[model samples]
Target chain A: MLAAPFQAEFDANSQEFSFAGVVRPRSVDEIAHSISMFRNAIEEARGVLYINVKRLAQMNNTAFHAFSRVVLDACRTRSDIRFVVVTSSVVGWTERMFRHLGKIEPQITVEVYDSKFYPGQAFVEDTSFIPILRTQTKMTWRHERKILPRHGMRPGITMADICCGIGDFAVLVRKEFQPARIVALDHSKASLAYARDVASNFGISDIEYSYGDASEMLLEDNQFDLVTCRHSLQIFNQPDLLLKELYRICKPGGRVYITNEKNSHCLGEPRAQSIQWTYNEVARLFAHFEMDVELGPKSRRYLADAGFDDILVESFMVTNQDGDPQDFADIITAWENVYAGEMAVKRGDPPEFIKRFRQGFRDHIFAALHPKGYAGWPIWAASGRKPL
Target chain B: MNAAHRQPAEPKFEPLLQFEMEMGTFLSDWHHCDQLSTYMARMISHNRTDPLRHSNFFSSALNELLEVSFRGGSPEGRIGCAVYRHGPKERVKISFPCPAGQRQFFREAVARTHGNDAYARYLDALSTDLAPSREVVLLDLAINFDAEIRLEEQDPPSITIVVDLPLEGIVS
Candidate 1:
């Protein structure tokens, strides 16, 4: 469902949009069917071979906490596990903590991946906070409604969306900045295929969809003027490694933008401390490497500790406005989908009560969004730059 | 007045309407309602051997009357004994072509069976009946004469209900 055939008739006679490999699921059932199709694909896909503690984090909290305590006790004598991926359901919180982690431990690179179910397949995107990113994007495409792209630029610089999920962000990014090169990376064949189809749909060939890890691939480093990591950390257990890679890959004078919301896994005193420690240690590593740093509001102190000189931290909250009923519904539905998906993935089973729980969540949102109901929260954004 | 010009609704129609309403309420309350239909149906059938004075005899008596009318080639084939217990607690049946649907018909039927106060007292008593006390109740089941309630020891109580029925000539 990810690729499409271009129409020569439209290209020759019409000035409308046309491209290659544009995938469109004919119906909702077809979309649901993709889940199993993706599962079969996963069965064939090779495992990267690492411990997924993030999956453990997805377990029921009470049980997970108890298990962690046992693990910690066991580790008292000897460390048993390393390399963890924490599946974070809460976006802004997750992003904030990861940023903080990056600052304190600039040596580690935490790649955050968001689990998204598109059409009939389930895949994880490099983006961690899907709800907020989708919200900031105006709830278009496979979400609430279709919106015309109107993205603002930071300056003269153009940025690329690496591991772009369905290219919703990439499409808007290309539409606005018309970046010199928009390279998107995703290992999932289906996801990359979909992204490629999306790029073709917009008739934008400048944006490239590559199927490999940016850190591992090392094909183009220090090439782009700007590198942006939005809501895509925590997928890497050794985030410290990622920082070095990002540093190595980006141009000497170029800036690396990393953003995430505060996350639940970054909560509780112990979990919080572990995250803080990771950030500080990495920051010390970065300083030892002689790189100037600027920690945004999300990772302020960590960036400072990471030896990032000339640190600049700014905080802006992306909000779902009070009158935006469509945004409200989309957020609730997406949030429930994410949470429900996490539960299913962790349990190693299909969502048993998805239909029932979805109805319950919808009812709850309708009640919450009525003139009698309103709720809002804040999202944290932070950026760190390399020494010029 | 001729039979065609009676100018009044038939007595049989009221009970049927009441039965339909009761069935609708039963389905709506299935998720949270404690009393199960299987248990209530069995209770009615079990009470058939008892005298009319028995507390559970009402449903059984009505069912028996329906059975005879049905066999006699009457329009009332069988009192479709739709038993439902959902109100606060307690098992209650509203048999139609019957009482509870038509106030006059119910009053007359109850008075004929017992006295003027009999139907009023039973209806009033049912309003304040106790809720079911079982921790877990299964609504759908096929039970037989030899039913067993097995309890397991645990902080939270657990029980298993088993029934034995005749399978051919072999009984275990």
Candidate 2:
């Protein structure tokens, strides 16, 4: 009897129906009744459904779960009906939630757009983005090398890197693991081109570059011996969809490795405090999903639920003390490059404030380096084996 | 007549025909140096009846000079070219107005300091007897060539390099 949180209109020409408005249903009965009406409309119209979640400001977990179950059930029962969820985000945590939902129902597809920087585009064109990614690659490789061998990563194995930005990790795997072949997949052609250029520069010949959404890869099932997604899981619109794809393409007994930053801290500064506050705010926004926005502690549960076995989770801290000053500078530059624009718009910070913060942070970092300035961050590495 | 009394006919010298070209400040990046050099080479070749030989000669010569300049970390500057014809020979001289960074590199190259053996080796590889002086480095193709550096006192101080390539095989 309560008004449904969404309105559905069928387009006769396109043979598709679109749902728009807030989707925060309060109770099971309300969610069910809404799903029933949407399902009946889809069946009657005999067209695809596109749920536009742009105006969907909030969705509680119970309502979201019910909505996902109904959609999946509809897809499973009606072979002719298709469903697509379209969402956009300017912040990291919101993107994570959408991506998580994508994995919940493999039959359903989720499309996410970056509404702020690089709007509606998958590849980032900023000149500074690649350099920052390169710096982060070095930091990540150091942690990855520790556990890769134990997880079936070795010489002569076929590997697929999902969301492999710029092919840095693929090249790293080639150098360290000696994989027989590597297929680096990303959605951004620009990123792929840059990766190919880098691979060419490095004289690496065995990599096959492909561009597509990792959630729905065009790769053969059970083809890869190892699949790895590093530092990208938290930002994916549907981490679960990609994980399912990772599991599907991976050979029986093959392994999948995923790692993400838990938290980053700078020594002797207010910058760390400020960053922590921002992260907390983001986490609070998605508290309904029970997601630990910073560390992504729920990733293990998601992996297990996706039918992975012998799951292992480990944490390590990397410190920037006594490292190259240029590397430290690059880290700071990368942070500013990624978060500055979004944070500026979200927090209404003026240009002067942003500039002062960047300069102040840099000075603080340099000043802290006296008897070895300490800057450190925590990362979580989780891996699981596909059932044979 | 006595052998000394009968003076030998003065060696005939042909009238000098000159060609000049200049590039602007916009095309003054290290990467654009090759492009400008290639353009100069083509211009020299355009006037010759045997375009192939002239093109190959100028192209190789300009490329070698550009390489040495780049290896020495020379700052790219405004480029100019002058071509002169004398009898059966043609001399193509390419000049560059050097900034202080390039001037310093050239001085080190001349002094053979700062572990600059690479530039020295390039110079030695290209030297010939037709070199104007010991200080001048020549790139001796079938055509003879020589390089000279001139320093001028100005507000910022500038160095100029004049490379003279004399074509020997082609007869006009």
Candidate 3:
């Protein structure tokens, strides 16, 4: 039986059928049943059957797989029936899923329509205002010591750094590992330009910079010996798809490294306590667009699901004990700038509230700079190898 | 040789105006370029009303263009523009620093204007179909590395753009 959230309309004359609204069928059996009904309808009518998934926002991996299976099955079984899956651009994960479907079943077509729910171009385009906190809090030396050694980098090994903002990690890898070639991918043109500049300045050659959506990379399959994404997984709307892309590009036995801040642990710190509130508010704001924040612990599971083997997960923290106060101030100021501007304004936060939030953030950072005061965020490093 | 070590030269033209701003903020806001172009157009339209306004607009455009050009690189560097009135027809000369190693990029950008005659096309677009009467004219645009004005040795190399905006009714 078709569930309440699922609605289907058919125009017999036009031979067009559409299913829209929340489609949370109870189980795989229900999805199969639904596909059967669509198959029957397609047999009776002639033209294309449009599956309007624009409104189907909340779909798990199982549901996604089930949908893919049904579409592929239909395409294989019935030659007469044509299917067109329509999705919204704002639902990036859904678009990625449909794209994956197209890859598997070349005959079916998927259309992604632009919607207002999508984050404005301005929001994404403003890459010039990257917070100093991002760099300051990175603890590069620590990452170098811990993560780089495990990679066993050597000559003739090709690597790809997805979400390689400004190519910090790429530069590091080139300098430390002496990799024969490295390709850095990022979505922002401005960021890629900066990365190119950085690479030029460092006299680092053999690093190619490309700009595009990381989820849908233009690189060839099984192109790299290794792949890494640093501190960017949580921001991706569909981290699973990103991981799968990483897996796809990575050669057999090549390892994939993923790292992000442990949000829960970081938010629990006394000096970083306010970050929790801010994160929750930001998450709530993003919820309207159906984007979820990945809170650090899910990296391992995502890697495992992507068919990665020999997985290892490590968590560590960095304290600001010997850190420069000026750097901390700059980080705080950067955070304040972001919060006071688009992040707060987009959420309909009042000027007074933004001002207060900025003040509170500054106060926390100032306190963290004191002798007794301590500041840190839990960092997670998860690496896994593709099956040999 | 570092450019900053040279002795600064005296001004050859009469002082007009100066404008300065951070490049990052300007680039992040998409409307700044349009706002700047509109302001320049207005100043050109109002040149007969006040000749001094021509100098101010030249200074503003020079600063804006430099900022837009140097968006992705180090955001820390400050962009400065100085306008001076010179030449036979009260031409306002504007100069601003650009990032080092970017001279080629800027040169290509300037050369790659939509049509063959960039100045004519720019004037037409800026005037928004207004018949080109005796008003203001863009005389010339050039870029150079003046050793006297280089700010820092370690900073990205600087290229100065010289734009001559000639006011119609004034004789400097």
Candidate 4:
């Protein structure tokens, strides 16, 4: 079984479970106010050197430390500052700063949470994360503008989400887009089960969860007004065949949105060529189908190519959840759970390298999580659609 | 002019003090009013000899200040403060920062440029352009004046003008 790093690892009989009940705050106004305060604190902490240099590389320690001092100060003021209560970048940066600063202020009990993989950095760019921190602002903006959902919502639109791992988008579709029928398919039964639980809790009746290969789902062509494959397109051993199947299943005037890690590889040295190749191949396949190709932020382009014209791709930021360096330590302790087994198989790295790589990744992640704009994960998002 | 206009016992001036105190409290809470003050200050500094004639910037500033302050608080407070926003019908006194000689020259220039029939021509032009939109309001010219007087040898003489813009057009 993959390790669960960000999650608390239980010893056979431990009495200290009081911390488990920390409910992550979801009020956007509060979060925005907190972030603003955090930003201000970072600006004030002009100089300080405290960071974990595990996973990140070639980072500027001086600036990061200075920045993190401010973040740490803000975290200190907010008594409810749990590891998950802030952006991911802040968590990593703060943990490291706390280790150093906590020594000086021994009274400060900074609970450092471990980084789960490089969780805070965005795997795909999306903006839903902003609402996570600045709820009131996002709500106010919504009320002030007539900004529609990126993809238009047509009542009774039957849709399918292939590889709907955890059903993040499924929940959104049900809540915001109000789709009529949704078939969420994924290969992992555990993940599918989890998705099912969430759908049930959200009271989303239209969604039906099934465990199966996403590419092989039995569906007629032109059956869905919208089909979405988010962050799962690159995992296919046979992406070309999968694309063909997706195209075949979509109805005329119906669009498909596919999101994949750019230049994805299961194992090997990571390179720019890999990311570009993913983009290039996807673009080529869509072009061949006579679909008007609009490629850029992966999800946005995918939607556009599928012929959805009113595609909106808003970018959301992801930071180290811990807001401190202990996040790196967390990454070292939790890499297995964070990336799942595929990361090891894909990297083609030896066990020793993998172990060291994980540790090094955490170190860098810690260093990067420093305060100021200098610390934290960098992430971007894209959403597009097909025409009609 | 000073000898003839001298008010008997300065009319007690108690009402003016009360108005000032109330206005000060309002100004302290209303952040946007500072923007108006800055605008007026700059306008007076730039064209100290004349203020009322430069109604474009002054009016826009006042309008923006009123909008932000009105929306910033409860409707009750806005209604209570409406009188301050829409001043009374008495002659509007706008202070300018220039010497008496400069003010006298400016008034003469205005009179000569327009001639005796110019106010009629101005009134005709003003009536033709009173359309309304979501963005801005139009007002009719009601009063115009130019004056020059030395006050304690420190402040400049000034001109003032007034226009009748319905309260309905000035959205809170």
Off by over 4 Å in 3: A1-125, A131-138, A151-155, A267-276, A279-292, A350-356, B1-172
Provide all candidates' interface root-mean-square deviations: 31.7, 32.8, 27.5, 31.0
Question: How close to the true structure is residue A329 of candidate 2, measured as C-alpha lDDT?
Answer: 58
The digit string of per-residue lDDT tens for model 2 on A236-321 reads: 54567668888988889999988865433233333555544443443332232332335446668878988999998887655565
B112 Cα displacement, candidate 1 (Å): 99
User: Positional deviation of A265 in candidate 2, in angstroms?
Assistant: 6.1
Candidate 3 chain A has its poorest 10 consecutive residues by lDDT at A115-124
* Cα lDDT computed for each candidate against the true fold: 0.34, 0.55, 0.55, 0.36
Q: How close is candidate 4 to the true structure, as a TM-score?
A: 0.33
- In order, the first chain's TM-score in every candidate is 0.48, 0.64, 0.65, 0.44
lDDT of 4 by residue, B8-123 (tens): 66221111100112333443444334334334423332221111112222333333323322322222221111111232111112222333454554344334323555444433
Task: For residues B1-172, write the lDDT of model 1, one tens digit per residue.
Answer: 8999787872231111123233234334322121222223234332121111121112222222222212221122122334322211122232323222333332333233334453333323222222200110110001111111222222111111111211111110
TM-score winner among the candidates? 3
Mind giving the per-residue lDDT tens digits that candidate 2 earns over B72-136? 32334444445555543545444455555666655554443223353444333222222122222
10 residues in a row with least lDDT, candidate 4 chain B: B11-20
> DockQ of all candidates, in order?
0.00, 0.01, 0.01, 0.01
Off by over 4 Å in 4: A1-148, A153-156, A263-317, A320-348, A367-369, A373-388, B1-172
> Considering summed lDDT, which 10 consecutive residues are worst modelled in model 4 chain A?
A15-24
Residue lDDT tens for model 3, B112-157 = 3423564455334222422211111111122110001112233345
What does candidate 4's lDDT look like per residue over A1-388, in tens digits?
A: 1111111211223212111111112123323443354454333432231222221211112222333344345456654332222111211222332343344333334443222222222321123322222322222223212323344345578787776666656776666667777767655544555566666687755576654444433343566776766545544434444555566556556656554433212111123233233334333333333222232245554444444455556433222333343443343234333332334434354666445444434333444344422222212233334433
**Model 3, position A244: C-alpha lDDT score:** 86
